[model samples]
Target: MDISINYTRGQDDPKSGPVKVGWVVSDVEAPVIYDPPRRVNSRDARREHGKSASRCPAVLGLESRYFEIACPFDINIGFDRDKDGRPHLRNLAGTSGPIRASTLGKRLSITNEAEWRYPDRPIIQLKLPYIFLADEPTYITQLDAYLHYRKTPLPGTIFGGRFPINLWPRPLMWAFEWHDVSKPITLRRGDPLFYCQFEFDNPERSVQLIEASMTPELKSYLEHISSAVNYVNQTFSLFDAAKRVRPQTLITPARS
Candidate 1:
């Protein structure tokens, strides 16, 4: 199964490969240490290999199935406020070109119609520019992209949500939400940003990701309803709006 990747941002950079296939050596020129989101690790063997959780098929299967999505840059964001008493967020550090952090506008509000804003915790969107989809649409009957954030060090702070990219055709983007705003949010380059897994309805199926070119027909297919959400409030209410604009039936999206 090939999940077509459009490197809208980092074209050849190894950090934003989006699919973790193998370990990234420490030789890459950078400052902070890069810890790969490997499914299994070969470390110090304290006990004899008689029985262990790591050796179990069921246990290793879960990790092996998931493809890791790594952060492309070293980003440091700090919370701040102005004299006017309105709070705000500032990007302290982020480099290596392409990857960036931005404040999510009011159009994409957390609530339906901004009835209740995100409190003092200003929401920031990680601008990870990459698009993924089951472009082949044959070997994989249905593709579901799930992004989870439990493996990272910042567990309770940075939030994770599922994105049905097969139907949506949106790029790889991240929303940052902090539990306790006291400490700043930081993610070093090559850090595990999200644990991405391509799922199918049948449990016996497996998947592999590959970069593919975006066809003109596929581009039109994606453009049909890609920006439709911005025209409305609350994504749940976009069914009617989507039908009006959706012009193609590339792959029937099972879930989002």
Candidate 2:
């Protein structure tokens, strides 16, 4: 399975052939996927003659392949509430390096819906780049993106989402539910933000993450589906909007 990825700021063409494992025709930065690191086994926890979690297939699979998204820059997140108790979130830039994140790029905003779960709390959206496409027709796979909150357990916070990226080309706009508005939460540059895990329906096929340029047609379709949420209640229901706006001739058949 070759999953192609492209970002909004990426260039459409590259004169240099494909990048070694994948290709990303981006002028600024290509979205990065990493092998999630595992903690080293301490000698004290080792059983001389017994099986170890270090060698367990399930444990290995969890750390094998994933996109480890990081903080774009150092930023502090704080909460505010009005007289009516409607919540608002604010983001302040911390110490930045020579290359600062774009003011718009690092902005985190709270959801505006009044009836949403934990409406009095802040739900912050961290917009990410990289849209995905799987090129295999007979096999099926799944991609899920969520915060690595379990590994970095910050109390009073919820990861807020896990999206099945295989069905749509939507950007990974990560929403985090902050339950505690007491004090601010700060994130330094390079702090791990989330993880995107790709799963298999048919476990036999090998999967590859290839860097690819976004076609004009695909970008147009993405724009249409992404904008649809602004007009509807079920933001999650836009998987249908993806196919509705895409010409039938362009969709690749998936194993249904």
Candidate 3:
């Protein structure tokens, strides 16, 4: 989709004229390197693969607050949809744009994914805004996971076939096991996703949230977040740390 917008420097005013903006994305820049794939058969392959994939651009800097809106035209400052209309929000597919709406905000949409192989994928119009914490803590989690795998790689597992998917599927089984380590949490299909605004004055403070949809590509980011969560959980086991290791009484020490 051809995305055209009129952006202002500080705040948007529809009555105002055109706004100037510039965007930077992967396709336009050289690919970033974080981790690399390892041989699948190695004892440490599992951890290695995890680390490698986590390093992929699709994985890094995965956290950000995106907003969504309906209209792509002039953003209405004070106007809001009727309570009955069920207005929503989301982000442009590859690059981060503010909230996009169905009938308002920056007019944007996604065309065929293949189209932007060179320049980079186009943006998907969003209807709401949301907050994603892609900060130092998350980055450290990824680094620790990568180091662990580099030190001790393990065999990786893969499953292939077709199965029925429900709102909630097997609590056990490979899928659940795999996800349990790094389960992906998502907003329901109909739920409105939003962009998060942070206050520099009070970094701890939360900002307003706009509504939108969760695109598939954005889902990739959620998956990365899942892996980050898993790495952190596995690397830092407070429960395990609290307990001291005790040798078994049955095993006698053999000393000269």
lDDT winner among the candidates?
2
**What is the Å distance of residue 135 in model 3 from its true position?**
13
| Estimated TM-score for each candidate | 0.59, 0.61, 0.16
Q: What would the per-residue lDDT of candidate 1 be over residues 183-216, giving only the tens digit for each residue?
A: 7677666656665555443344455444444555
Model 3, runs deviating above 4 Å: 1-197, 201-206, 233-256
Candidate 2 per-residue lDDT, tens place, 113-208, comes to 664476555667766664555432222122323323334344245453444443455655556667666767666666666555444443322345
Tell me which of candidates 1 and 3 scores higher on lDDT.
1
Against the unseen true structure, what C-alpha lDDT does each candidate score?
A: 0.47, 0.49, 0.23
Error of 2 at 102 (Å): 8.9
lDDT (C-alpha) at residue 255 in model 1:
28
What TM-score, to 2 decimals, does candidate 3 have?
A: 0.16
Residue-level error in angstroms, candidate 2, position 206: 4.4
Per-candidate clashes come to 0, 1, 59
| Best model number under TM-score | 2
Weakest 10 consecutive residues of candidate 2 by summed lDDT: 15-24
- Candidate 1: segments with Cα more than 4 A from true spot: 1-50, 93-118, 135-156, 234-256
